[model samples]
Target: MVTVNEAKQKIIANTEVLTSMSMKPSESLNYVLFQDVRASISLPSFRQSSMDGYAVHDSDITARGTVLEILAEAKAGEGTMQVLPPGAAMRIFTGAPVPEGATAVIMQERTTRTGSFVTIEDFPVTPGRNIRSIGQQIMKGSIALPQNILLTAGAIGFLSGLNVEEVSVYRKPKIGLLVTGDELVQNGSSIRHGQVYESNSLMLRAALQQEGVTDVEVLYAKDDLRATIDALDELAGRNDIVLASGGISVGDYDFVGEALQSIRAETIFYKVRQKPGKPLLFARRKQTLFFALPGNPASSLVCYYEYVLPAIRKMSGRSDYFLRSVSMPIERGYSFDGERDEFLKATANQDVVIPLDGQESFALRSFAIANAIIYLTVNQNKVEAGDHVEVHLLPA
Candidate 1:
């Protein structure tokens, strides 16, 4: 068995990012930036007032009880720009463009206004103190945002302020899911005595969606070598990635390996030094990719998030899109199977993440309240309280 580092390397080597696509900024939510954006015009474009106050020249705000004559009123989005003369002030509201030749703003509360004259209570107000200068937030021709930044709400807001209504980003890759089992039954149908719930496919679909995948199709195949092969052949190359669960182990009904080999899909890696997901397999053909995951619900979800999501992010044009978990302190010092790296179910509260019920893979209730997976490598499972561990959050 190879170490976790080897497995990670194998996974990274098989990844290839997809091409870029054009999209409206409105539809660009969750899309990755393809290129760095530079500002064309200065943010604000003109000096403006930041508060509801009076815009005045430098000489108008000097000495105690200095009096100034009001020239004109400056509303937020006024008609034409004007120049304020010396010893003159303009009644300006919030966000109003600061008239030319004016450098400071005094709040209405700090000055007494009567008729056309105003008296300053606080003398010697600092010039340009409350004015938002042109290009202050963002300069013309300056880098607005770097490439590969995820299109979040704040990023979208920045783009909107810059009047950019469209952008180029990498689209999400489509994936097809194939589940194979003879003892499995869909939830809607009545189950026979020997049958069990078929939940792995649904879990994997949800996990992929949580990773920002938009297109997914699921199909089930009866546990027969020929039938599984036929199903896979039907779905070949129709998806950017194919996720197959079950039929990877050395069982009588296992046939995914045989089918992949027959299809001539290049096998990059198979098996990893991890519990419950040690039977993972990865393959590629042309631009189409495939992954064979375990059938158990928890195992299926864990494996897909750990390996498949990274591949999806890379394909989405995000350079640093890998899942990063917070290194939260653990609650206890405990022992685990020292054979492979374990991603035990865990729950995070405040700053500490606690490991929940630890049971066999097939037991679904063990993960009822789990929000994260605590990482523990083989041969070093014991951890003291406050010792930080990597945590992968589950998609709710």
Candidate 2:
């Protein structure tokens, strides 16, 4: 077994960012941009009215109660141009194009209309008032968004507004899941004396979906070595990342290790010195990455969050690939003398972190509600109330 830090280092050293692909901005949510996105045309291409008001030259409004004739009206999306004569106003609505020869816009609330004329109450209307100048948001031919930025909903909308149809982004990874166990049965099936519900696939699949990974295929294998090897071969052939749960430990029925050997995969690390997830395995075959996680639900999830998730993020060209760590005060004191490092499920906020109950590998009652994981090394097993500890926040 290797140290936790050693395992992480090996995984990072072997990982490489995936190639970039061109895709429509509408379908590129949560993807990292591979290149700078430039604006082809200035935003708001024309001088626009910011409110429902009258458009007029600044000199036209001479007095507070000056009455001016209301020329042709200009509504939003009006293609034809209307010229505002001197000493006259043009009726304009919000987002409407400012009529020719008009320099100011007075909101409708500050004026009263009678027939074809309007009286202005607010005096000394400033030039360019309530008018959005061309390219006020972004200039044409300029970088609208920088490279390496994560695309959110707001980003997508902004790009769409700029008329950007497609963008280059890091490719999203496709994963394959292989589950190994003869005693595991799918949920809703009747359980025999030694059988248990198989929940790792569903739980792990959901976790992957939260990371914006939707292309995943799941397969099951029995305890037999040949079946395990065949399943591993099939999954590794078509996926960028292969995930296997169970059959990693030194048990009699375990066959994942032997299966990997049969496929001639290069093992990066076999295990880590960590509680709840010591039997973790990471390997590589050419460009594909593989992780064999422990069978227990809680242990499997912990490994996924700590190791597999970061790999996926890195492959997708994200710089913030690891779990965010914060040092905060503990709510209660705890003591443990475990031989390996321990990752305890906990709930935390900006102020404090509280380690929860039922921390066993097989128990998930606490893990289900946990938003963070409190890390405790073997040498620092004992903690006191109000002591500061390292906590890793989970992804939402």
Candidate 3:
């Protein structure tokens, strides 16, 4: 078995980044940029009003209670080409282009408009106040967004404001899920004496959705070598990444390892020296990467978060793929005699971290309430109260 760090390195090194594609900004959320996004035109291409106010020459407002002639009205998207005359102001709305000769804007609340004249009640009018200069946000022919940036809603909106319709981004990988276990039944299906509801796919799909991965196809394979092999072969051809849950451990029904071998997939690593997911299996065939997670619900989810999610993120061209980690003091002492390193479900606050019970691989009740995972190294089995521990914060 390989150490956790070694396994993670191997997975990252072997995984290939998907090719880039041109997509609309609306459809490119969560995708990493392949090229630098340069601004085609300057943001706020014209000097714009930032508020619904009066645009006036700064010199015109020499003192409080200054009166100026209302020249014209400039509404957003309907600015006039007429320049402002000296000692005159324009009724400008937010986002309207500031007329030439105007150096300042005063809020409507601070001014009293009477017919064609307006009185500025406030003193010391400042230049460039309440006005967004041309290219204030982004200069034309400059980098609006650097390469490798993850596209979020704000990024998309910014690009859209710059009139960028399409973006070149790393394509999201297509995924295939193979669940191996005859004892597993669908959630709505009638259960037999030995049957259990199949939830790994559901949990994994939801997790993948959180990462902005939605193109997933799920298939159920009976605990038979031939069936597992056929399913693996089919999924390998269809997806860039294939996740197979269960049938990885050395059990009578375990056939994932044998099936992968029969299909000629190269095993990068068979197991990792970690609790809850010790039997994790990683493999590859040509361009397709495979992860065979442990059977238990908590084990599968843990392995997915620790290993599979990183691989998926890398394939999609993300820069930071791992969960956020922080060091915190344990609220209470905890003792364990386990030989493998464990990721204990826990809740953490700014002050302390409290390890929760039901940490067994099959137990997920604690996981449901956990906001973090406390990493306990194999060599350090016992933790004293107030001792510092590394915690991996979960996504909210």
Instruction: Pick the TM-score winner.
Output: 3
TM-scores across all candidates?
0.91, 0.95, 0.96
Ranking by TM-score: 3, 2, 1
How much does candidate 2 score in TM-score? Answer: 0.95
Output the better candidate (1/3) by lDDT.
3
**lDDT tens digits, residue span 1-396, model 3:** 998889899999999999999999999999999999999999889999999989998888889999999978888887356588888889999999888889888999999999999999878988998999999998999999998999999999999998898999998889999998989999898999999999899989999998999999999999999999999999999999999999999999999999999999999999899887999999999989999999999999888888888989999999788889999999999877766788899999989999998999999899889999998888768989999998998877
The candidate with the higher TM-score, 1 or 3, is 3
Q: What lDDT does the true structure give each of the candidates?
A: 0.81, 0.93, 0.91
Query: What is residue 226's positional error in candidate 2, in angstroms?
Result: 1.1
Please give the clash total of every predicted structure, in order: 0, 0, 0
Candidate 2 lDDT by residue in tens digits, 44-107: 8999999998998889788899899997889999998778889899999999999989999999
Please estimate how well model 3 matches the true structure, expressed as its whole-model Cα lDDT: 0.91
Candidates sorted by lDDT, best first: 2, 3, 1
lDDT (Cα, tens digit) per residue for candidate 1, span 1-396? 566668666667777888888777777777888888888789989998997878887676658788889889899888689789988888999888999898899888888988998887867788887899999999989988888888988888888899886787887898988999999988999989999878887777767777678688887898887788777766766788888999988888899988888877888888888976888888888887788888877777677777887778888886654556788899987677558888888888887999777646766676777888888887567788888888877655
